[model samples]
Target: MDMNASPVPKAVVVGAGPVGCLSAIALANLGWHVTVYERRSDLRAGTHHLLAPNTENNPRQRSINLTLSARGIAAVQAIDSALVERLLHNAVPLRGRMVHHLEGNTTRQQYDRGGHCLYSIERGLLNLILLKAAAVVKNIDIQFRHKVQSVDFNKNTLHLCNLVSGQELDDHFDLCIGADGSHSVIRHHLMLATQMEYSQHYLSHEYVEIRLPQGVDSSGHEAYLLDPDHLHVWPRGSFTVVAMPNKNKTFTSALFAPKSLFDTLQYPDTLIPFFKTHFPDLLSLLGEKRLVLELQSNPRSQLITTKANPYHKGAVIIIGDAAHSMVPFYGQGLNCALEDVRILSILLRKEKDGHDPSVILRVLNHYSETRHEDLVAICDLAMDSHLKMRHSVATWSYMIRAFIDNILYAISESPSLVDLSETIFGPQVPSWSWLPLYSMVSFRPDISYSAAKKKAERQERLIDSLGVAVGTLGLGYIIYSFINLNRLF
Candidate 1:
């Protein structure tokens, strides 16, 4: 039985977001018949169609800009380097974070040494590009405005409703993938089919969007009011505001605060003063009138962290936010989701060589087993980062430790030092090769999230021991100097 002569498996992908589109492209590349179903109309039809104007009644139109790191870029590149390059052309590279403090004081924290950067891109635009790429594939079919109402995993059939024509339809496939985000219909049916462990936890904080229009520089050319090369953050003790630049020269900003805070600022009188007291520097960039309008108009969206075990069962598999929806602090949610497609694609390709369609069950099981730990690791990291971004970024101790970690990273990168260390300390010191937690998570595509977390824990312990040793030596030296001075006197 030659597997090469076997017919390609038909795959149904729910949702037309970036993850779904990427999955379709990957499946098509792997010689699968792919069909993508999207509930919303095609977004690439008109200019600013996705970017709905800030209205008094509706506010959840456009999402915060996506920060694309090495993990995501690697995933896209794996599918098509040309597609990745096209996406990068519209991205604004962000090297680090610019922390804005009270009294107009600002501090810059670089994410990595040696010029590593993350790209900021409009989410809608990126989705459009991905959909376009998927559309061109001969083996892929994209159906817009078709909502999946229910799924029967045992039967391998989908109950879908056409939003445009108001017609219900049934679609059958060899495999059904749910990338329909946190509230997924496929995930719901999977829960009914099997005992799937799932949990959704929401943070007390909620966020609202604020748009910062482009301004003119001294030369009368368009320029960014804030540093365009860095993600701008105004971190308050209990809340924070972040802004990311777009190619259109505007910055999409979000104000994250407690629900109680949002409740109090329902009117202009309270909202205007709140911004004045907490984020005074933003007044010039986002004028008082515009800020008030956006605040009053924009909906306050909650921050949620969702986790599910056994992302696949039978012929139905869940990926992206449907599997593990996380807070956006670590900026790895989308990256991890994209990586899911890449990994699953690899597994399916490997299984296809067996020429047995039943091998998909084993492949999906393997995927769920292996991908769970990394998903959990990243979810934990994202939750922890909320505190680090809002409060820890302002502390001197955090900065000092970051500096020390970076120095060690620089040393590890030196070929001579690495060679000498390997010769002296041998394999025992291989684990000591300095890689900061941020670098491991954001910059290194080779390391899995779980492995990175474990390595970080070990490095943290080493740093703690080194800190204690250095403190003790300083104290001993001071005591010796004092004793000698007393004898002289």
Candidate 2:
């Protein structure tokens, strides 16, 4: 059978966020008829709820701005390099983290020795850009305000409602891709069809969105209240405040704390005093009036970590948060989700030589089996990073180790030296250089999450051995000096 003469496969993508939009784009580019169904109003139309000021009564509308790294850009680049260029033009580059101390001090921790950095972009803005790109594609149809009520994986059918017109309809597809996020309706339906091991854990902590407006600098020109090149962080032990810059000179900040602490700060009297004590510098940046207004108005959202095994069943598959949702501490949730699109695209393209329906199923099954290990590694990594962001980043011991490791990395980068991977593992491991865990995850798209985790563990063991060797040498020198002093006496 001629591949070109075969009927084009049709795919139904659930959810219209960055991941969903990217999925639609990739599938369409792969010669599939793609339709994207989004439950919310089109943010591109300016009617989306996120455009309005977030209030206490509003649904979860606040945007947790994304930190775009190598993995995410790789996905977009696969579809269109121009789209990557457009998105980065609108984003502010985050060189590293700006750690604000309690004692009125700040420190910068660069992400990598090689100068790669993440880009900070608004969530709604990113979605709009993707939607615009998808709109231009001839093979894609985007349906906004369409809610998925139920799904039958075996039948490959979906029951959907038009949220705007109150019309309900049933749609069928050759393939179904679920990107509807952590609380996905498609995921719920998938569970009914198969015994998918699933689990969700809600952290005791919650978060509220806050805005830091531009302020006049010493020269009287309006400027960013915080450094635009860094992701500003106020790590206060069990709680933390993070701020990411926007192109408009303002910043979107979030306060993450225990729900018990949130309960105590129900009003200005409590909230103001709490900020004054723990985050005095940020209090001044936000100002007393605006601080109280935003704190009281913004909804407090719970943080959740979701995991599911075998992300596919029959012809249906789940990607992004629908399969594995992690906390934002590591800032890889969006990056990882976008990477799913990239990985899936590679697998699906392999079967393009022949339009065999069975080949598609085999590819999906292979994806589910192979992709889970990397996703699980990242989900666990994200959970562990919460402690690092809130506590370890501020500790003196952590700083010292990071400094020493960075120095070692710099030395290893010399042209005269052998590849770090070969030096550590063996000559057969190829020439990948050593990097810090943050660098490996964020800067190296070629490294899988599982490989990065395993490599980081190996790096830690090597460092421990070096520490012991250095300590032993110092002890031997001290003993010799003591014996020589005793002989002189």
Root-mean-square deviation per candidate? 4.8, 4.2
Stretches > 4 Å off in candidate 1: 1-5, 47-60, 352-355, 414-429, 478-489
Residue 40 of model 2 has an lDDT of 74
The global Cα lDDT (0 to 1) of model 1 is 0.84
Residue-level lDDT of model 1, residues 305-332, one tens digit each, is 9999889888889999999999999999
Lowest lDDT sum, 10 consecutive residues, model 1, at 417-426
lDDT (CA) per prediction: 0.84, 0.84
Q: Which lDDT value does model 1 have at 26?
A: 83
> Candidate 2's residue-wise lDDT over 1-489, tens digit each?
787776787899998878888899888888889999988777676647363221323554586688999767876776677889999999999999999999999999988778889999988788788888888899999898798988877678889999889999998888899998888888888898889999999999999999889878899998998889999989999999999999989999899999999999888899999999999999988888999888888888879999998888888899998999899999999999988887788777766552365887898888889888999999999999999888889889889989977886776542222222112111222334556778768876767788879878888888899999999999999999999999999
